[model samples]
Target: MKHLADLLLLGDPRLYQSCEPVLESELPLVPDWVADLHNVMEEIRAMYQFGRGIAAPQLGIMKRLIYLNVDRPQVIINPELTAVSDEQDELWDDCMSFPNLLVRVRRHRSLTLRFRDELWRPQTWDVTDWGLSELIQHEYDHLNGVLCTMRAVDAQSFRWRPTPTH
Candidate 1:
């Protein structure tokens, strides 16, 4: 589709520079933008086809936006982690930013997030377990211009193991 082709992929020269945070209250949450996000979510979901979360930056949107399908379609702006999980873990997460590339990233096993709801209401929720917590962390990283790959502590920490042959 011509529309899909317009969305630049990683390393594409036209991918716009990300903008600074647009305060939570400033987001266009009406059905137009929100509904469009649903379409974007579908494309992003299908784009990865086998991944967890995808951020707006990965989709070439400069806004501080995130869309995930774990519990609900969590749309967050200016998201910040108020509290990290009591437990911590090193997780191997793959990103659509780099297809088929996986890297270990440290994340709180749980979190209490201070973010706006879909309606732009300031709310707090305790994200338990990996699904919601990991989703939140992944999206939050994008807002901060940090991708999953950069989380790897060092070059040695990431290894691409090809198929073993006899």
Candidate 2:
């Protein structure tokens, strides 16, 4: 099982490489991968108190897979974004890869997410909520070797996350 310590950090070269699509023949391995992802995500949540989604590459899986647990657990495979709105919103986005930093970036206010479920069934979701939309976009960027730091609005858009008071 993968742990928080296995997570790829911000400066890892693998994090800058684009991921490959998960093949149909690889479906059998997805369960274990998702389990590891869930474990690491849970650890991130426990340590940093914020994490809604994580990509496979974050754990060095190097596949177009994302595990998201907002209202519930969701396994997204080879996701594609469509119907992205021209409207945008700026927010301080954080990542498990660099938990102590946040990047100010602009994201689409709404989008349509198309992907395969764990059963290899096609699924579509219209994400209109700003929070969910941004979360999905952030994860999708990972599959393309794009980091939140790359999307920063400006050089001054990066900030350290506030340390909690004991």
Candidate 3:
């Protein structure tokens, strides 16, 4: 399979459309796609020096899959936010799809997520760190066809800034 090159940019219809769940029949492809996503994310990070997580929709795959390079790299399949803490924080958010812009948005400070690992075994992750919570929430929004731009606090909160390329 060809490695994904162009991530779905902002205003792309695919980025705003809900992705379909990966069926059992498609499980075999998950590993390869996850690897592809990993490669693309690493390439993005190398060039732009940013990007911690990526969802399948950003790659134009329209599947409920996300790869996160937090403490340890992991692939999340069919992820669902089981719960969120009452605390919320507003932070600048960026995405691979629109690397030139940053939007300030509010996100839960803590959240509970349930997802299947690369092996298809169910797993639960309880996130309390504000940064990780925001990262996961951002990917979760992608799975639901919501972008940081959509969640922007206000027009004045959106700003265009070039990604850091060091």
Highest-TM-score candidate: 2
- Number of the top-ranking candidate, with lDDT as the measure: 2
Ranking by lDDT: 2, 3, 1
Per-model TM-score on C-alpha atoms: 0.74, 0.98, 0.94
By summed lDDT, the worst window of 10 consecutive residues in model 3 runs over 1-10
lDDT scores in order:
0.63, 0.96, 0.88
Off by over 4 Å in 1: 1-8, 11-19, 23-25, 29-37, 159-166
TM-score of 1: 0.74
lDDT tens per residue, model 1, 26-71: 6664334445545655654565555455566655566666666665
- Compose the digit string of candidate 3's lDDT tens values, residues 27-127: 99998888778888888788778889999888888899999997889899999999999989999898888887889999999999999887889999999
lDDT of 3 at 47: 73
